[model samples]
Target: MSTISLTARALLLDMDGTLVNSDAVVERVWRGWAERMGIAPERVFAIMHGRQGYSTMAELLPARPMAENRADNAVLLAQEVADTEGVVPIPGAPAFLTAIERIPHALVTSADTALADARMTAAGLRMPDVRITAESVSASKPDPEGFLKGAAELGVDPADCVVFEDSAAGIAAARAAGMRVVGVGARAASLAPTAFAPTLERVAVTATADGGVRLAVSP
Candidate 1:
C-alpha cells in the first residue's frame, strides 16, 4: 500500500486505544457490570471504547436515571484505576510521544484526570502538557467538544489539526471538530478516517518548518 501523508499545525491524541491498551481492565469492569445489570455483554462492549464511563452507562441504560449512571460510572472508573495488570503502551507510542515533545499537541481523551494519569503512568507514557480530559468537557466523544477544546488549547485551527484515534466515537468527534484523522488500528479502519494505519508503529512524525507536524502513515 502507498504511504499516506498528512500535515497539520497540531496533533490531537486519544488515550485508550491510541496510546495505551487498557482493554483488559475495561472489559473486566464493564463485563461485570453487564452481568449484574442483566444486560447483554456484547451490547455493552460495542459502545464502551473511546467514551467516558458515564456516557457508556447512559447509552447502555438509557431509561436509567442520570444520577444512577453517574454513580455507577464513578465506581467503574475507580475499578479501572485500581486494575492495571494488562495496561501497556501501544506499539511505538513511547517513541511517538517523544517525537512530538516540541510540537504542538494535546491529549483529547474521554478519561477523567485520575484515570488518565493512572493509565498513562501504567503504560509508562509521557503525558502531554495540554490535556482535555472528561472533566474538561460537558459532552463526550462523537460530540466534538473534547477535540474542539484540545484544538483551542493548542492554539491551532481545527482544520489544521490531525487527530489520531482508534475508535468510531473518537474519529467522529475529530471529524465533527473539522479536523483530519489518521485512524489507528483495526477499530478505526472501517470508520473511514482521512488516513489509516494498523498501529502507531506504522506511523512516522516530523516537525515541519512552518511550525506544523507531518505524518507519513503506512497502510
Candidate 2:
C-alpha cells in the first residue's frame, strides 16, 4: 500500500518510537522503577509502550496510591529526560518530517508535555505547530482522544488526517479517530493499519500542483 496516495489534508504523528527512538532510555528507567517496586521489569516494559508515564506506573503498581505512582513516575521521567545522550531521531524521520512540513501536521503523543518537549529537543526535530500531548486529553491512546484533539487543533477533520504510528495503542487511536494510519514498525503493522512500512524512509508523500497528494510505498 502507498502512503502518499492517502487523501488527507493533515498528518498526525506519534513521538516516541515513531518519530524518535527513545526505547533504550525508556526501558532503562522503567526497568529501574520495576526493580525498586519489586515487579518484573519485562512485564512492566510490555505495558509501558505508547502510554503516559503516570498511566504506566499506575498500571504496573496498582497497589500503590495514585499520589505515590505520580511521584515515582515524575522522578523516573526526570531521570530519563536528564539522560538524553543517546536518544535520536528514528531512521527516515528527518526526511519524512521534511516532506510533510509544508502541510499541516500535529504531534499526538501519549507523552506528557514535559517529556514530549524533552524528547523532541533531544532529537533536534522541529516542533509541530500543533500538538496534543498527554495533558491535552483526558484519555490516552487506544481511546483516540489524542489523535482527535490533534486533528481538531489543525482545523482538519479526523477523516481528513493520516496518522503515522509505531505502536498498537497509537494505531488503535488513529483508527478510532476515523483516520487512516500508516504503521511505522513491525509491531504496529501487526495491528492492521491502512498500510505498513519498515520505516518512514520506505514511504513517500508527494503533493501535486493541483493540491492533491500521492502516497508511495517502496518494498
Candidate 3:
C-alpha cells in the first residue's frame, strides 16, 4: 500500500499490544481466572485487552460487587508484575520510541503504575516521561478519560493528537476523545483506525516545523 501520512501535535500510546508484547503473561494469568470462573477462555480474551482487570471482571461478572472485583484485580496485577518472563518489545519499538523521544508523547495504558513499569522494563523499552496509568484515571479504556487526560497534560488539543493503540477499547476511546488513531498490530486492523500499521516498523515519525509530528504509515 502507498504510505499514508498524518500529522499531529502529540501522541498517545497504548502499552500492551501496541509497544510491548505481553500476551504470554496475560494468558497465563487471565486464563487461570477464566478457567476458575468457568467462562470460556475465548470470551475472556475477547474483552480483556486494553481494559483494567477490575473492569474486565465487572464486565464478565456483572453481578459481582465492585469491591470484590477490585480486590481480585489487585492480586492479578501483583501476579502479572512479578512474572515478566516472556515480556518483550514489539518489533521496531525501540527505534520508534527513540525517533519520538524529543517529541510530545505519553503512555496511556490500563496497567497500573507498577505493572506498567515492570512490563516496560522487561521489554527493555524506556517508559515515557508522561504516563497515564490505571491509577491516574477513574475510568479505563473505551472511556476516553485517559487519552483526554494525556492530551491535557501535554498541552495539546485532542484534535491535534494521534493515538497509537491495538485494541477495540483503545481505538474507541481515542475516537471518543476526538483524536486520530494509528492502529498498531493485527488486532487493530479491523477496528477502523485513522491509519493502520502491522507494527511500529511500518510507522515512521518526524517532527514538523510547527512543533507537531508527521507520520508516514505503510502497510
Sort by TM-score, best first: 3, 1, 2
The global C-alpha lDDT for each of the candidates, from Candidate 1 onward, is: 0.92, 0.81, 0.95
Best by lDDT: 3
Write candidate 1's Cα lDDT for 75-97 as tens digits: 99889889999999999999999
lDDT by residue (161-216, candidate 3, tens digit) is 99999999999999999999999999999998889999999999899998888999
Residue 121 shift from truth in candidate 3, angstroms: 0.4
Model 2: residues >4 Å from true position, as ranges? Answer: 1-4, 208-212
Q: Any idea what lDDT model 3 has?
A: 0.95
lDDT tens readout by residue for model 2, 7-55: 6778899999889999889888888888887889988877778877777
Error of 2 at 4 (Å): 7.9
Runs of candidate 1 exceeding 4 Å displacement? none
TM-score each candidate.
Answer: 0.98, 0.91, 0.98
Worst 10 residues of 2 by lDDT: 210-219
Supply the TM-score for candidate 2. Answer: 0.91
Write the candidate numbers in order of decreasing lDDT. 3, 1, 2
Measured on C-alpha atoms, candidate 2 has an lDDT of: 0.81
